[model samples]
Target: MGLRHKKASAGGGHSTSGISPNSTNGTSGTSPDISENRPSWRRDPLEYNLDRSWDINAAPTTRVFNLTSSEIQAAPDGVLRPLFVINGQFPGPLIRVNQGDRVLVNVTNQLSNGTSMHWHGFYQNGTNWMDGTVGITQCAIPPGESFLYDFTVKQFGTYWYHSHFSSQYTDGLVGPFIVHSPEESKIQEMYDYDQVVLLQDYYHDLSAALLPGYLSSGNENAEPLPDNGLIQGTNFFNCSSYDSDSGYACDQNSTRAIFNVAQGKRYRFRLINTGAFGEFQVSIDNHTIQVIEADSTLVHPVTVNRLPIHVAQRYSILFHANQTTTNYWFRARMNDYCFSDQNPVLDTDVRALITYTNSTSDPAPTESVDWTYALDTACEDLAPSSLIPYDPLPAPQVDITYPIEISFQIGDFALDKAYINSTTWVPPAIPTLNQAVAGLQVNNANFTTSGVSTAFDSSQLVIDVPTYKVIDVLINSLDEGAHPFHLHGHQFWIMASGAHGAFNWNSYPTLNMTNPMRRDTITVDAFGWALIRFKADNPGLWALHCHISWHMEAGLLMQFQTRNDIMRGWAVPSDVLALCHVK
Candidate 1:
């Protein structure tokens, strides 16, 4: 992986890697000295523009955007810090493109370090190289380099893009992506307005600065607890929580994010947990939330007062403003049960103001109360069986079953790292994708016909399918902490999951063939198991890994090479191949 290097120069001169956003090399690097030397291909970051008025039935077209990644000075929740943003905006631009359209997003790396973006839930079927995974598919885009991610929107629903590098997204490299289609017309009528709600656990310090200590040998998987939480890039933090000598600037009167609602209107809130860790229970005082979508799959509406959302998961809820004209609290509570310890400055209950009037100055009602349902001690997702996809597509029959045992063990150096079965993943100099393409094209012996190939390094646990096959993956978690496993290219049908000892093979034939919950990310409870199945119709290297930023860095990831018959003829584009020469 090209992720271990640092800036070539510490005492900043003209950076070959590109200038920081807050440095003398301003937003566009307009200075006379650097202008001529700057790459003309580099462009500014894109601005988010999502118009609800746009016709969902409009003809599909190409959507082009230029995104520049750089450092910026900002206060997401009134805590001033250096944030990595796109176009100088926190929580990068929202990408909205209609279904069946082509999206050409050119990303320019202006940060002093390298980074790559992963489209959270898109099945990059034919365009696997454009999946933007830092190591498994391609190397990290070098500093000051540009990579054009050209892919077609094959599915319609709520999705997101974020830096897939080690703990990079934890620092603030995230934004929402929405794909519209004519199928949304019926659901569009169910809500008066639509909005994107982002709920994340906020940290005052950059993740890069904290990585060293967290990875130290003596640490026992004790993750750094969040100092606060944010709802859509803003929140209220108590300035007095830190003393004057604490070296942190604080504002006592920090404002909270406010959403104004008209009386009797139903608003659809697209909730995404972009946080690296922490599961949240989100709700509005006195309002019943009707969940219609989960990870882009529209579900039959189910009403609840509070909804539990884990890391890398999403849900769209409809709430009607049937209460009286007044201000109410929209609360997001971080479930601290999952953390080994708590931070002194952390206020686990994060709230925003939901006002009926345009004047956000209206004070929220103090008498508001949280829902009576108690938060669970275990970190998990909402029950999968409870959600039924509106479209009702049943899962196909399984052709192959891969039973992966997930556990953690101290390596030879006494450093704890996650392992899938006997092998733990570390990025190779040449990506698995590049290696597969070259080997398959030559009809190498490693490209076996039996659906399992050992062509990659021994440290990687890879399953190779030379042809299309339906896969049943039994992820057995042997660790104490719960894991949210996210598959890169396809949404799998979650056959079943629980904190049981192990999956009974006798129940395999008895599994339901009717509609089951299908999503890209699913949580496997501690010392438990989950059986998920997906059609391995996509061609390319797809990663199945724990979504927790820390767990992923601990080597808790594996890859699947599907449809090698199709990949054998792939001619990897020149620009994608250029990244391997970064060092």
Candidate 2:
């Protein structure tokens, strides 16, 4: 119930060399040691050969992964920083499972702090306790305590997993989560090779070290700018850029990640923005990326020279290696507008290499041109119209509508915090899910089905739905900053969005019922409003909040307790029940 930190010494004790024992060793059968496949200057492609395609109704295949959470002295961008790693890797190992498979991740906390792993974009339907959202679904896995995350993968495509407790993930507790389905098998024929490219904004300090300064009074919500950016956990940074007196040990020899491509072959690059903040404009010079998937939605291929991806968003792009045998920059440029505070060592332009040769030696720089299109001036999502899911499924009619407003408030004593309507979230001693189940069994008067909350805990806004209902959420952003709002346990259809003042109720009947962009995370631009609709059929408590680590920590979150009729008699597992009892 309390935020924990493992104090990291501020000297030159970090190293970015060597492979972790838990990393994948480029082999089949038992779980591979993921660090063995860590991206190097001239490493081969990280294969997506794991079996993920299966019949939807077939008996669920159980897959187990041993995830060890520990502290690591890592330099993701050559600047030493303390990272909360998983299985000894900076950007944790990938978890690939079939759409209908049961994923049991046994997580042992070796760090000196509590942690919980949220399966980003996973709909934990019948097993909401496994949603892994600390204080929302269950308590954090206590330090030295082990917890089993058991959930079924209902949806498929490029998704991710990260620490959902406080700002822990920003310090390096993030990784790729790919769910392959029958639909992906049909799309796989379009490309010969599949790989993952992680783009992140790097900081030289632990998030715990930065939180106090950020949360202090009078800061005015100015976000901490990153020291650098990374491509697949590696990038080049000049040691001389930071003064020796600056207190950061910079290694000038740190290498950038390299992807060796065979000429004339087509490759599918799954790009995941796992950074705490910073929307990256990803581009590989002289190459046109044909985007075939957005988040977990498989879409009709849309081509672009550059793709602007916000936090927690994923895109699968296909590109042909038909160019001349030379090295080209694979860029993931962190949007400068996202940073209010600047860092002298920060190079917003993050780059990696795409080489035709297998040599680790640096290749001769070749001339490459960026597309002529103007860059996006606003931090918004890629247009919803451009992405149409290949398998068109019409959105169901809304049974009820909830018009909510999200804003930031400078509370008493000038402390800045975010709010969803009147409730500014603070972690409950017992999860809302646990509270709801207990309340429902006793028929607590505060609990209701499908309407406004009746609970009086101003900090915990619980939307109680006794039965299944189709809900429409019209989200209005009262703040000046754009927020990437993500919903747990379900993907919603983007019915309508506008940068204008409000959602005109007059246009309700004219909304699109045909297939719209259905994704788990969406952005509501500054002073903008977006109407999203989803069927609240998933049975359990789900957290809907901004994906920004800073904002979420500042109380920008709310929960929905759906299908309480099914939850009243249910009981949370003993292992999960035990986490709350730890001191």
Give the root-mean-square deviation of each candidate in angstroms: 9.0, 7.1
For each candidate, what is the lDDT? Answer: 0.79, 0.77
Query: Which tens-of-lDDT digit does each residue in 8-70 have in candidate 1?
Result: 231112212222221221111122332233222222111222345656776767677777889
The regions of model 1 sitting more than 4 angstroms off are 1-50, 361-367, 449-452
How many clashes (backbone atoms < 3 Å, residues ≥3 apart in a chain or on different chains) does model 2 have?
8
Work out how many backbone clashes candidate 1 has: 0
Q: Give TM-scores for every candidate, taking all chains together and pairing residue i with residue i.
A: 0.90, 0.90
Query: Tens digits of per-residue lDDT for model 2 on 335-441?
Result: 77645545677888788777776545554555556667776667777889899989998999899888888888888889888889988899988888777777777
- Model 2 is weakest, by summed lDDT over 10 consecutive residues, at 1-10
lDDT at position 195, candidate 2: 77
Candidate 1, residue 156: CA error in Å?
0.7
